[model samples]
Target: MGRMTDQPARWTQATVYPDMWVDPDDDPRNSEGRAPDGELATLADFLANYRMTLRMKCEGLDAEQLARRSAPPSTMSLLGLVRHLAEAERDWRRWISDGDPLPKLYGARDADFDGAVAEPGEIEAAYEALAREQAATDAALAAHPDLGERLGRDGIAVRELLVHRIEEYARHCGHADLLRERIDGRVGQ
Candidate 1:
C-alpha cells in the first residue's frame, strides 16, 4: 500500500483492534441504556451522535492538523468543517426564530472554509463559535417540540428540518472521518 508521508501507514494498512475513533468504553456516542423511542427523540439522538462524532474525529489534533486540506485542490479540513457547521447551526436557529436576517458568521460565500486558518486563536474561535451555534439551535428546537410545525419563509416543517440537519451532519462527519484518518492513520466509526 502507498503512504502519503513518511509517517506510519494508515490503520487500513495494518490490523488494529476496535478500528474506531475511540475505544467503545470511552466513546461518548455509545448508548448505555434504552434507546430513544419516539420519532423526534430518534432524530435528535442521531443528530447528537453525529455531532459528537465530528468532535471525536477532530480530537487529539493540533491547529495545523485540523486546518490541513485533504489535498491541494480541496478546501476541506476539519477546522473548515467546524466553521461550516457553525454556520449551519446558526442558519437553523434563524429559520426557527423571528427576526431580521442575521449576517453570515464568516462572511458571504465559502468564507467559512476559506477562512479556516491554522492559528491557535482561529482554532479556538472556530470551536467556540460552533459550540455557541449548537447551543442556540438546540434551545430553539427545544422550544418547538411539535415537529409538524412549519417555519421559515418556505414553510418547511420542523420534522423536515431535523432530518435535513441530521443528513448534513452525517455527511460532514463522514468527511471528518476520512480527514482524520489521513491526518493520523487513525480510523474508526
Candidate 2:
C-alpha cells in the first residue's frame, strides 16, 4: 500500500524485536528445543503453531471487529480468515481421510471470502467451525499413523498433505497478522 498524501504514514508492526514478531521469550510459537525431531512431529508442530497464532490474533475481538474488511479493495478479514481456514481444514481432512470429494465448502468461486459477512452468530460460528475442522483432521491423522501413507485420487502422501496444511495456515496467518493489526493497534501472535 502506498502512503497517503493527506494523512500521516503508518509503519509496519513493531515489537521488542524489530526483526521478529515478538521477543523470543514472549513468542508463543517458540518451539525451540521442545519441538521433536520426527517428520510428523515437526509438521504437526508447525501447523499447530500457525493455527494457534490465528486464534491468538483474533482474541478479544467483537463480531464487527473480527469481520471488519479493514484492508479495502481486498475482502480479507479476521472472520473471513477463520472461515476460510475451516473450509480448508475440511477439504484437506476429506482428502486425507479417504472421504468422497464432496462439493467444495463455499463452491468453486471463492465464495468463502466473498461470503465472509460479519454478522452476530457468524463470528462465534466461524471459530467453532475452525475448532471442529481441526479436531476432525487430528483424529484422521491419528488413524493413519504413518506419515508416508498415501491417500486421495492422486495418491498424495500423508506427509505431503500435512506439510500443505502447515503451508496453508502459515499463509493465512500472515494475512491475519495484518488484519488483526488493522482491527486493533496490537501486533504479534
Error of 1 at 113 (Å): 0.5
Model 2 misplaced regions, further than 4 Å:
1-26, 97-99, 106-108
Poorest 10 consecutive residues of model 1 by lDDT? 12-21
Q: Which stretches in model 1 have alpha-carbon errors above 4 Å?
A: 1-8, 12-16
How do the residues 121-184 of candidate 1 rate in per-residue lDDT, one tens digit apiece?
9999999999999998888888789999998777778998899999999999989988888888
Clashing pairs in 1: 20-188
**Residue 18 miss distance in model 2 (angstroms):** 7.1
Model 1 reaches what TM-score against the true structure?
0.89
Instruction: Specify the poorest-scoring 10-residue window by lDDT in model 2.
Output: 5-14
